[model samples]
Target: MADLSINFAGIKAPNPFWLASAPPTDKAYNVIRAFEAGWGGVVWKTLGEDPAPVNVSSRYSAHYGKNREVMGFNNIELITDRSLEINLREITQVKKDWPDRAMIVSMMYPCEEESWAKVLPLVEATGADAIELNFGCPHGMPERGMGAAVGQVPEYVEMVTRWCKKYCSLPVIVKLTPNITDVRLPARAALNGGADAVSLINTINSITSLDLDNMVARPIVGGRSTHGGYCGSAVKPIALNMVAEIARDPATHGLPISGIGGISNWRDAAEFIALGSGSVQVCTAAMLHGFRIVEQMKDGLSRWMDEKGYASIEDFRGKAVANTTDWKYLDMNYQVIAQIDQDKCIQCGRCYIACEDTSHQSISQLIADNGARKYEVIKEECVGCNLCEITCPVEHCITMVPQASDKPYMNWTQDPRNPRAVAA
Candidate 1:
């Protein structure tokens, strides 16, 4: 197997897969089991200061599919409920006992610099590999001036990050909130504050649905409730886009990224790495499947790397970034005309109905060699929009063929947002 190890901003992990800061990393027991199961590291669950806050029961609920597969995980749980002294002791013992694994302390305190400042020295005393500022928790702590609320404002992001950088000698990783409009602002804020790397995304705020029987939304809070952070495979695409935005942005370019959200297997891990993530993080998947799942991820990634002739994680990182671009940079001059495979068509006019009502009226229905409804494309009328192709549910029924220099792409070129082809 090829090497799966990664050196993330001077913190090395045996592999790019690390358990995110969640239930999976809540304590030394769980973390050690995860390490034994092959996870390269663990970001300990977010810990708060002394006088630990009490948490409500039923603080988490999951969204699932027909087969009861969890598509998303929602939680109103706040930072660690364990007292600060006990958490610190455990962190110290865990690090001293297991020196090879990356043990990062996830921390959140009041927004004030003093609140964060007081916690830094205690955390560093644990000999932790790094510190992840827990700025992404979306549910219970916003009003306290922590979590997503602070994360959304770039100023707070910079302010708090600076606080950590000043007081902590270990590398500081700013865990970003996905609740913002544009991801770069917080990323830039972290970088501006001298963060060594950034890990994303914290969680997306979401309201799953209501529990009508209780006359409230779930998971019930004091007999009522509000939205919580949504996570798992459902959020993967959004997470990938945010990660890519940060990875490719010149303002934050070359920043070490810890890709989080919806990573279930090696394929998901590889995709994040290819998009320029130095390491990948997972929580929901491990919560559902347990730490043993990491064995599959490590084995699969190693085998695939050997097959692809990639000797290390760095070998293929950002390999796909060049192919991603803004809409205007797309090859609009290149076009595709719809084509139908006669043998593959099951005489379904679903394509014709779709084209006539919703798309370019290009395909004309006619009875061909056999007494079957055959659809032929009128090339001149074909706009290469791929609507017919998309409408056809049957595989290989409709195909789009490239048109060379047939027409100037004019659909979006006329928009005010199109700067390149403006009135020239």
Candidate 2:
């Protein structure tokens, strides 16, 4: 079996699957339940100064797929509504009870250094392993100069991160917001402020749906609604791209990352690790499915690592970063065409319709003598766009087959068609 343990920025955990700071980690009861379910750790929900903010009822909304499966989740809920003293007492007890598990406290404070200076030591006194600056809450907190309000500004990100490092003895992990124009700017800023590691991406600002009858957006509050922080499976692609950018960035390269956003399964966790994440965080998945899902995640990752002959997470971490490159660097001479497997075809014309109507006219539909329908790929016209492959209803019904070519490897930067092609 492969060892799944990780020492993420010096905070040790039994595995990389940490429950992100959300409703699931809001209280000691939930955290203990998650630990019993085999989760490696938890970032205790975001805490603030005394007089916790009061959250409204109907704080959640969901985006559903054709089958009514939740594609994403939106929440206007703010940080922990419990008083700071109560949260701290629970954190102390939980850490003492579960000494082996990572206990990271997530916090959001006023921009003033005095505010952080006052609260940092109180949190540290809990014997927690680390502190995560909750700079990415996209909804309620930002209205009060916390969350994304601070995260969107790189200078504020650096300033607050510096304050945490200055006052707190535990490792500081800066949680970054995806709402920014350039995520790398804030990531580099975190590095400059002496952050031990960074985690991302926090929920996107979104409105999942609307009640047309009432003319209000989802999670309606008295016939009115406000946008909430969006997260879940739909945000995975966006999150992956941002993680890759930070992993390969020259300025912040090698900075530890705790990947977040839309990670639903073990494969999602593995993908994040391959792209340079030291560990992975989860919130939406745990909310959608219960905590027991971590069992499958752990089993699948361990089996896969054993199959790949990896002794530990570090062996394969960031292995894919070297191959992730700019579009201009991709080989332009590579060629592949779609091939339809007749035996596996269910005679579904989805591929044909999708290609003929919206994409290149590369799939040909034929009528057999007996009045049966058949679909075939027109190789000469196929652009290898994979539209037909994607639309095919059956698995492996259409595969992109690479063709033999004598041409040398060429990228857009060296091609003659480019306006700034280099001379060979």
Candidate 3:
């Protein structure tokens, strides 16, 4: 079997799939059950100072697809509502029992040297493998000058990370918020503060949808709602780009990453790993599908690794980072044409309508030799936009095939079409 084990910043785990610091890992009960279900690690729910914040009755909202499947999920839920002492006790015992599994504590505190100084040791006393600075909860916590409030400011992220480093002996992994304009700034700040690794992206601030009937946002409690953190499969593209940005940035290069965001399966986990995440974390997937979801992630990743001839996670980690680049560097002279297979077409006309009305008129509606309605690509008019390919309903029915380039290599800097071309 391919080795799924990862030693991220000295925190060892049987595999890279860990439960993110969410409700799924809130208490010993949930954490224990997750471990039994085969999750390699758990970043215990964000534990703040005593007197945890109260939660609203309806703390969640969701965006659904046509089939009523959740496309994205939003939550106004706060951190651990249990007492600090209770959390500490449970963490200590759980670590002792599951010594093989990685247990990292996620913490948030008031923006004070004393506040951080007070909590670091108490959490450290639990013998937890590591500590994650939870500066990325985007909702209720930010209002109190914690969570994303602390994360949005680079200086504060560096300062707080420094406090943890000074007061605690374990490795510090800074959990970052995605609400910032430039994610690299906070990532660089964490590195500057001597953080061992970084986990992202916390959550994006979003109001999923509003109830037209009541004219209120979703998860309305007593006729009110506030913007909550949005997450799930919809955020994967955003998260992937952010992770790739941090991974490829010169300043934070080689910095350990624990990727989190819309990671519902092994392929998602692999993509994060390929983009340079040392480990992957999960929350929404588990919350929706239960802890049992980790089983498929583990099995699928391991099987994929075996097929790819990768002996271990490290073998293919960061492999895709090299291929990620700015648009200016892309091959401008390259071209491809869309090919539609008539046999696979169900005569939906989705591609034809989409290409005709909105996109390039590359697809033409016509009759095939079999006397059936058909859609054909107008190769002359096709710009290789792939819009029709994406709009098509049948899988693989429309494909973009590379055509021989008749033009020599030329870029925007050299092209006559450029408004401001440099003197050759």
Error of 2 at 18 (Å): 0.4
lDDT of 1 by residue, 247-363 (tens): 889999899999998999999999999998999999998888888998999999999999999999999998888877777657556777899988788777988988888877888
Clashing pairs in 2: none
- Comparing 2 and 3 on TM-score, the stronger one: 2
**What TM-score does candidate 1 reach?**
0.89
Lowest-sum lDDT 10-residue window in model 2: 214-223
Runs with alpha carbons beyond 4 Å of true place in candidate 3? 368-371, 406-409, 414-416, 419-424
Best by lDDT: 2
Which 10 consecutive residues of model 3 have the lowest summed lDDT?
Answer: 415-424
**Whole-model lDDT for model 2 versus the true structure?**
0.95
lDDT of 3 by residue, 182-285 (tens): 99999999999999999999989999999999999999999999999999999999999999999999999999999999999999999999999999999999
Per TM-score, the best of the predicted structures is 2
Candidate 2 lDDT over 284-347, as tens digits, reads 9999899999999999999999999999999999999999999999999999999999999999
Candidate 2's C-alpha runs over 4 A off are: none
Model 3 clash pairs? none
Worst 10 residues of 1 by lDDT: 407-416
**lDDT values of the candidates?**
0.88, 0.95, 0.93
